[model samples]
Target: MTTVAAPTRRRGLFATLGDIYHERTNFNFIGRSRIWLGVSSLMVAISIGALLLIGLNLGIDFEGGTQWEFSVASGNPSSTQVREALKDTPARDARILTLSNGGVRVQSSELKTADRELVTQALSNYSKVDASAISIVSVGPTWGEQVSQKALIALLFFFILISVYLTFRFEWKMALASIIAVVHDIFITIGVYALTGFEVTPATVVAILTILGFSLYDTVVVFDKIKENQSTLGREKGDSYSSMVNRSMNQVLMRSLNTSFIALLPVISLLVVGSGILGAVTLRDFSLALFVGLLVGAYSSIFVATPILVILKEREPRFRALRDRSGPSVSAVAVESVVLDEENVMPAATPNPNDQRVTPRARQSRRGKRR
Candidate 1:
């Protein structure tokens, strides 16, 4: 019976650390299945398509509109009641969203002094029970537009600077791959907002940009391992570049999981606690997007970025030259030989210098010599 060798196990923290630093063997989740990778990439592409078609549901902060938040301690107010109260107000297309702590948030396209008064009076109906419960906060459309423009400019600058930095730190190909992954995460997060019709406030922009930075950091970690593995694996015989990349991904997979888990803890807390305490709907939007982006970011770094890179690099003439220069080419040749049955019935044999002519008696003599 044939037996298989067991895989080498990594032992001790120091050994594992050494392996990570030296780009030795490790395990990765995406490395286990190409089918999963194909599905994830397709999903990302679909998300991008949706974003391009419908665009994000930009909040008043982006397109210049007024936003108001009112705190009320009444019996839980319904959306219908809030709308009816402010029905005749100057503000057009008013929206009311319920908060976790039984408070209601009111927002509108734009507001005037008269509109504010009407809103105050309508809200006063609930305030009669608890006079100090309702508080109104408002931001002008001009300020919203300026904030939006600045946020967009900041995002553009961030993308350019990060791309340049990654190119310098790793390779241009890795940098491009990282950037594409970031774009994928961004579009998916934006699509989530659009599909669910979540408000895209200033806070949402901040969260998106933060996730972009995090995604880059994760991609860089994987690429750094790939770079090291490329150098080491090149020294060994029968190790393909694709195999080296797969090995590097496996090595860094644990690190990626640990990093992602640590990062997600805070974002999850913000999503749960910030909404309860802060009474800001924007917090939920921001945290949700960040959470989703982080997950997609980790996935892209492993599957999308590295696989795409292997596909690209393998196609290059330089890599082909390297493969050829590093190894000898084989040529086909033909030779004649003889075979003997168990009863020592020998097949016909031809004499050739490259082929051994073994007679049945000679085979017995060779077996005796081995014994």
Candidate 2:
């Protein structure tokens, strides 16, 4: 008898990257879902704790204040000079920050017209800038309260509308799961903002609202795939809800990542150059909230949204029957292969999450195209 060599298959240098981009890679997302779920739960817990205890730092737009802005040829005021200017005055609690436009921003609790004029005059004289260079504006506590109320109302309405839409468009369970994911994103984003002591302005509110849409788009991409996969589900044999969900996720994973990356590119530029370098306080406040929201939004759609949906789906009578009848597929078995070294291909043991002995998605269409 002659000994024969077994031909081994080799993965190319860019095989992994190509697979991911082309929706051909197999990742055990549903198999490892519990880990991801636990991670998300822990984050939400921390965020909620921070929100209840620390609270958000509201901006002048939300809290009543008198704001004065002006330019000085000699540059902005130092903290020492700002302190000296407010010394022995009711406006001693004022905040002074430098603007990118070589101007100074002065803010304090509500001041009477006389006091406001006096404060402006003092700053003008100290900076030796023209009197006309100083501009002052007042905001009432009542108005701030109103804005806060309106924001809350808008948020409530948005939630209601989204829930109804998701319920009808997909299924009730998907709707509920999506809500949980959206909530997760919001809580984390708000918590990060609160912890950073970033001022919550109207611009920040707008950014947060915008995040809901982005999160929804990412989530819908996955859910739509899940629904499509569900159609072909019963037609084929050996398909479990877990495996189907995992397959759907893999199909849309790369598209989600690409979309998030493209969206973040401009937002990052705005934060770094427009806000940090240019010192545009408005842009800073706006960009900070958006940056956090965009990042968390992207995260929740995959890790937070799909897992919840799968768990919910597994509860249905139809899926339950299919899961009980089916076993793992050949593709599911091959999915176990993972590269160990540049040239060494290793077959990983099936994770088998259930104590009773269980297993794992086929690669699908790229970028969520219609079947």
Candidate 3:
């Protein structure tokens, strides 16, 4: 004849923060693998669609062009001034850049010999420099193709090396998952660039490679922890592989966040301050790629890589058997117990063969064994 109120669950940022601080977070990352994987699939599909339809905005460096560099001897002229100076010439639609060293660089489609001379004269007069002082370089499409080929070769070599190293270090499954995550990061980053029409320069390529390394580092850290826990805690306690992976993820979640935060700060600074405020075109190209790549890299390492690893691992007979034996409730309780163990707010759980919480089927089996 008595009614009791159920305890309310914590919600919102502060509660989540408290849970994280107290190491009482029991996030079911592995259990919700479908959601994470579905989101990634959507992103990848959109990225591929964009690539097929819109394509990347290849810069003058990749597309080949005529470039002119000159420093003003009189006064600093803004990009508008440089543009106006070229208005009467054949290079009217040229891309003008303000260099950090108080110089201006102009790029346009390859011009004829007479047109090039005329443009040089125009830039020289605008900057009050001798015609000879203005430097001009022309790149052809062949050169751009060569650059593309070299970059692709380097990327392929990097992938091969990573696959071999990771196979030796962990297993082929981890390597495959990590590589897939890295590719996911790349596609997303490239899709952003294509959608935004950002120029794909050499600097962007360099930043993409750098972020891939950072993504790999994060994935390796997580995989190492999972391996450690699987061999020690998981084996001793007979926990499922996915459960061990989930625990390992919770353990390293904070560390991953801190690393990503630190990595993003300088990149954001470079993008916002260096490029946006200071108007450095090269920095803009470099930092933009780094910013996008780092964010997606962090995401793929956590959501994409580990989930894929769990899926691949659960296919193995040993892990599949463990998953089958644990069942849903046992797995849930096991994850909660991990939180309790870390928080130390509750007594350590010990297995009891006759525990009432055991399923009726398990109890029946025990009774049959006793008979």
The models' CA-based lDDT, in order, is 0.70, 0.81, 0.85
TM-score preference between candidates 2 and 3, better one: 2
Model 2 lowest lDDT segment of ten? 336-345
The true-versus-predicted C-alpha distance at residue 47 of model 1, in Å, is 2.5
**TM values, all candidates:** 0.73, 0.83, 0.78
Please give the ranking of all candidate structures by lDDT, highest first, separated by commas.
3, 2, 1
Two-way lDDT contest, 1 vs 2, winner: 2
- Runs in model 3 with CA error above 4 Å? 2-4, 7-12, 69-106, 121-135, 233-238, 329-371
lDDT, candidate 1, 311-334, per-residue tens: 677677856655465453211111
Candidate 1: segments with Cα more than 4 A from true spot: 1-37, 49-55, 126-133, 276-282, 321-371
lDDT of 2 by residue, 275-305 (tens): 8888787888888878888888888888888
Best-to-worst ranking by TM-score = 2, 3, 1
The model with the greater TM-score, 1 or 2, is 2
Worst 10-residue lDDT window, candidate 3: 337-346
RMSD of each: 11.1, 14.2, 10.2
For candidate 2, the TM-score is: 0.83
On TM-score, the leading prediction is: 2
